[model samples]
Target: MEHRVVYLDCYDGITAPLLLGALFDIGLDLNALKKAMAALSLPAHTITSQKQDAPVSGRSARLALDAPEKAVPWRLADTPALLPPGTLKELVRQPVLSMVKHIAQTTSKLQKLPIEDVSLPDITTLLWLIALTLGLDMLNVDENYVSPLPMATGSRQGPHGWEPLLLPEALEMLIRVEAVWYSTPDNKQVSLEGAAFLSELASFEPVNFSVTQVGYGCVPGKSASDGGQSLRLCLGNLSPSSRRAPQPAPSPVQTTLEQAESETDWVTVLETNIDNMSGELLGGLLDHLLELGALDVSYTPMQMKKNRPATLIRVIAPPELGEQLAMSLLRETTTLGVRFQHMQRLKARREPRTIQTSFGPMLVKVKYLGEQLISASPEYEECARVARERNIPLADVYEVARSEVQTLIIGSRKKT
Candidate 1:
């Protein structure tokens, strides 16, 4: 069986409660989730559900702040005293520790406090709750692959970041759903039955993942406010191409003949609107799409109704990968729905080659037929780096790269 990975692009921000709600929406048995949370020995936080109405339709799940009135702090200084004897055995698993690290980081960011300022007890309690959610053996501890929490950004506020206690369990549900979702056939990504439930609930398009493993964590705060508490779920897996079997090399003429034989290539254009996504998450999603064999993907800034800023995501991928890619758009970003259109295209045959540059080697996509080189351009990564380091516009760097490549080939011909 092939293992897939799902990447959650948490750009705008993530809250523990929303994660929990999404989990409940996906099919996590509330009773089981509660039992795992109980083992953590935390405060008496209650979980409740309701019909959520987004711009699209109705959804059923737990509210992040079940009852703001009933809220009480689970302070760090009181952790050890609260834990049941030997229950520590089940509270220190990898899933638990990973959650602790994430929750602590988010809390620190929310409070605008240093990670150094976060109480150790709070971290411990968070970890214990994660263990409780997973029902993992306390003795089965292992190091995690990725670091906990993202590096703190400059924008943050408040004293303590902790808010929701239901996030970890909620994340466990999402992790499980994402794992199973990634395993469905490529066509399922955009099918009415595949992402229908999630899309309707969140009012966003969807994101596709080759999800292999999922790890859960919690963040303090509520979703109503920008940086409130939430759950962080890490969906891990490789890109689609990496999963494919190797193909034998073809001779130059054979490749040309095969290219001629290939019918007009068709692809779908996917578009979605997102209000809460961060710039960082958008970048990650685009990179992921390219890795998944997308021909092109881009985002544009726009003002959504109510005068709030938003982004419009656009992607062009092979027809087969269309569904998964579209779902990924909704799953990873804050988009509720996505529009799709199919179109055919004609392209000159192309080959990928590397060209030496003044800074280093740069990759170029060259379109050609027989001995004629029709067109070529420097890779975007190289151009972007040069533009940033030199404090120049990207277009300027592109012009320079093209000039350099042309000069190199022309000079070589003269020398010959």
Candidate 2:
């Protein structure tokens, strides 16, 4: 099944209520959302949605929380404790849980605090609600894709020179999601937080995606100057051939045609020399960079000055992420300088295909180059996982996948 792509346009800025409001506007059943909230034992809240013309022509949702007349600020550590037994396990699936954990760990590291120390009740609650609404399936999101612009950092003035306070929780949410941050015209302090939140969520600028629907949410007493005081949530579908699209049946003729028209693009290569960092740290760094969207990362042994043994770290990434990734390298590694170059790479048309094996279903990467089958390999990670679970040799699983792919390819060729 194709994963759904949802975009949050915080043109006005993001708040907990605004996030919920947007989800509600986007066809999330109000009863379902309320049930999820109740499962979490959250405070009573009412949702109101209506069509509005200020920001754009769309429906908007608003959430009103019923709080005590005098409520004390809650500690971030205690937020998760409020959830009912098995609530998180039931509501948040593995994929969404992975993302949530990433956010918590990253925030904890960035803030120089324990994971439990990072807390914002409203943000945490809203995230759970959003997760429950969206379910646990992984979105077809690129690992290395970063927003072209950064989120707004400073406060902006209003008609009366009133500066809006940016919400730390909002900013943290954007960073955790790895969304781009940017400043929009007609900026106001009131919208800064939401703007930052939305900017990051809605940051897929160059990709060709179509917004199938739009949802809006509003926060009372937090209106932007343009009267579009609501958060716009856009649910988009990636263009055909998106990685997130379902794998089509293997077709050698179609694969040949695509390979014939395959295009080459310039890819950036970044290298840095390091001697001080430990091998364990380098390994971890490689994993981090790959997760951040590096096309490839490697380390080569070389001799530095004074006959000292060192490792030369190399990273290949798309041109769009060259600078950002380069900056990350400097920040994450002990290297002070980096050398980079761009070179053309010819990529074969490829897609993933699943084959039934004695052990289980295994995925194989089928590659084609201009009407000719170039390569086919079992996805190592999948094979490894199946091997461990089945208590069998990894080579047996690999051979099964390879034999099946070979049979398919040969049969397709004979048919053509």
Query: Which candidate has the top score in lDDT?
Result: 2
How many pairs of residues in model 2 come into backbone collision?
8
RMSD of each: 17.9, 13.5
lDDT of 2 at 165: 47
Using Cα atoms with residue i matched to residue i, what is each candidate's TM-score against the true structure? Answer: 0.32, 0.46
CA lDDT for candidate 1: 0.48
Candidate 2 on 1-416: residue-level lDDT in tens? 23256665555655545555666666666665556556656566665566555554455555555653433443444534554336654223322333344445555766788887665435434444343344211233222122233344556564547533454444555554455556655443323233333332334444435677776766444346534466666667653345332458859976665648765666789888998999999999999999989999999999997899999999999877886888788778876456565555667778888877666677888887766666778899998998899898999878887787788788767876
Give the RMSD in angstroms, all C-alphas superposed, for model 1.
17.9
- In model 1, which regions exceed 4 Å deviation? 1-263, 354-363, 369-371, 380-401, 408-416
Q: What is the lDDT of residue 113 in candidate 1?
A: 75
Candidates' C-alpha lDDT: 0.48, 0.59
| Model 2, position 359: C-alpha lDDT score | 64
